[model samples]
Target: MKRIGLTGGIGSGKSTVASLLVAEGAVLVDTDAIARSIAQTGGIAMPAIEAAFGSSVIAPDGSLDRVAMRQLVFTDAGAKTRLEAILHPLIGTETQRQAAAAGDHAVVVFDVPLLVESGRWRTLVDRVLVVDAREETQLQRVMSRSGWAPEAVRAVIAQQAPRKARRAAADAVIYNESLTLAELGTEVRGLWKLWAAATTR
Candidate 1:
């Protein structure tokens, strides 16, 4: 199987590219989805999360209070490390399990939002595809799509690896700025042909 790592900063339309790849027959193992699954009520990681952050970060429904946790992580430097410590291993294990289960898929894409920050995914995949956009574009897109304040969007961007770093890590990059959906789809299709050909060879 060909393992491809797909990543991009917030508001770069990484998820859209991922979906397009899926439409083109790539089996997607989305780490973000895995993280959510493992953080739900009664999930495998909740006990550890509650133990680390206390009940304040857990909602009444027993699921994680994402907003509270996000605030904490942003305010407390150590909190982000602690949270990653608890979740990364679980995410990695689950990612592997899912990838193993994907039988005969020509391309298996691992959609990891923090691929550059993770420090390990670089060596795990055959290639890294970055969906790139300028910081201003990211700020505008995120604020508009999520109704977040501009500063809030910037804060999230600050926490991620810089655009240059992501670009440097990429084996391929899809510049997602200023493209219409149809144009973006065409771009993904073009990459699909090249990547599919590569895997076969």
Candidate 2:
């Protein structure tokens, strides 16, 4: 089994790459999706979140108040650390279980947003596939798709590992600079063949 760590900064078109890989038969274990699920209303991490951040960070429907939490974490490192403490362990456990369930001879893709930051993930994956794009492109895509203010998007970007660092960490890099959808698909297919070869051998 080949566990490939797929990562990119926010608004870097990572999901598109992940979808293309999925279409090519790679089993995806998306950590962001797992985190969202666990933080939703009545989710596995709710009790701990409510206990740590209190009802202030929980919505009326009982879901985690993403806006509130996001604001807090951006300004308060302690709050972010505390939240990560509560969620990272659960996400890791679930990710491992899902990857194991994917079985032998399968290429398990761990779609993680912070794969570069988490040294643990580097050791776990056979290869690191970084989806790359320029900051200006990322800001435009994020603002258009998310309806987020440019400042907000920039703030998020500022918190992530920079473009150069991510590029430095990649085993293979997929550059998203001005590439059309067809081109991107072609790139993914080519990479899939390489990863598939690794698993089959």
lDDT of each: 0.94, 0.93
Q: How well is each residue in 1-201 modelled by candidate 1, as lDDT tens digits?
A: 899999999999999999999999999999999999999999999999999999999999899999899999989999999999999999989999999999866589999999999899999999999999999999998988999998889889999999999999999999999999999999999999998898767
Best by lDDT: 1
- lDDT for model 2, on a 0 to 1 scale? 0.93
Candidate 2 positional error at 63, Å: 0.7
Model 2 bad stretches (over 4 Å): none
Give every collision pair in model 1: none
Model 1, position 141, has a per-residue lDDT of: 88
The best candidate by TM-score is 2
The 10-residue segment of model 1 with minimum total lDDT is: 98-107
Q: Write the per-residue lDDT of candidate 2 for residues 1-201, one digit (tens) a residue.
A: 888999999888899999999999989999999999999988999999999999999999999999999999999999999999999999999998999999997888999999888778889989999999999999999999989999999999999999998989999999988889999999999999987887656
